[model samples]
Target: MSEVKLVAIFAENKTGQLAAITQALAQAGVNIRWVAIASSEAFGVVKVLVNEPDPACEVLRAKGFMFSLLEVLAIAVEDQPGGLDAVVKTLARNKINLRNASGFVAHGRAVLLIEVESAAKARRILAKKQLHILTQEEVMEF
Candidate 1:
């Protein structure tokens, strides 16, 4: 899989938190490509893979939002039954443990952003299986 720099945004896990973040990004002209949220009562983390990571980061920083960057793998799979299973099974066979994963389907393809024990090794294994690993440029195109 290709390497990607994903943004981890920390915010309050209450009403209007997401809206405020979205509005700030909108005003900054940044577009969110894919997003996932992990939350509890006190706070929340919004993991966003945006079209322009730099601008998104800048906007968030300007607004005094606490955030961090993550290096992850982006995998492209067929949008069909068992497609995800095929990719995951390969990792399992190699004993690669997944930390977390999130995906979205558009343009008839499913893109899975994964954090695993070793992304490089995972990429090698997936390549041998003929699975498609999405490059950062490829993701921006989507």
Candidate 2:
């Protein structure tokens, strides 16, 4: 099991904000694997999983956007009913708090990137349940 650092960038709620950020990544040669965005009238937060989180953070920071880095678990689970529920239930049983989660399916498998209370513990828990936790290189391959 391995953990990857996710970069969440907060930008003003206006046109061209997301484009500028993405352009920066593109110019820097960073490959984005997964992304999610949430917003309100005031601002927006973009959560991104990329090949180079540190460099991504630097690029965004250099552009004057507010951002933070977080450690998240990227687990590959069976793509079937109850797969997500089983993982959630297991975390609940262990009193692990999940701050956020996002995922997508590829080749009949579900890859979930979750922000939990403890990365190590979460990895151990998932491993005990026979789940494949992805490393940075593995995630990039997806």
Candidate 3:
């Protein structure tokens, strides 16, 4: 499991916007690990987990893109039935709210990146349940 920093950029919902942003990151030599985009009628928010978030932020800021930095949880769970269900159910039982979640399976492990209201509480809950929680250094090493 690994914990990575994500730089979420907000931009206008217009043509060439996403391309320009991606180009900036590419030119800066930043590698994107995972990404998600949500759009409204007027604007869009692009959430990107990258190897170099600080530099990526500088790139986007120079391009005049509004952005934010968020610390999130990246956990590796068993790639089997009930893997996600177990975590979700546990959080639900503890009344922990999940803001956003995304994941994929690779090499028989389900890697989940989630944003919750409280990282400490979430980590505590997961630890109490004996689940593995990723650290920032671990994520960067990957």
Q: Which model scores highest in lDDT?
A: 1
For model 1, residues 51-141, the per-residue Cα lDDT tens digits are 8888888999999999998888888888999989998898989999998988888899888889887878998889899988888789887
Q: Give the TM-score of candidate 3.
A: 0.91
Q: If ranked by lDDT, best first, what sequence of candidates would result?
A: 1, 2, 3
lDDT of 3 by residue, 11-36 (tens): 89899999988999999999887789
Per-residue lDDT of model 2, residues 1-142, tens digit only: 3457788888888899999889999988888988899899889899888998878878888878889988889888789998898889989999999988888998787888899888889889878988888888798777
Query: Which lDDT value does model 1 have at 95?
Result: 96
Q: Which candidate do you rate higher for TM-score, 2 or 3?
A: 3
TM-score of each: 0.90, 0.89, 0.91
lDDT of 2: 0.86
Ranked candidates (TM-score, high to low): 3, 1, 2
lDDT value for candidate 3? 0.84
- Steric collisions counted per model: 0, 0, 0
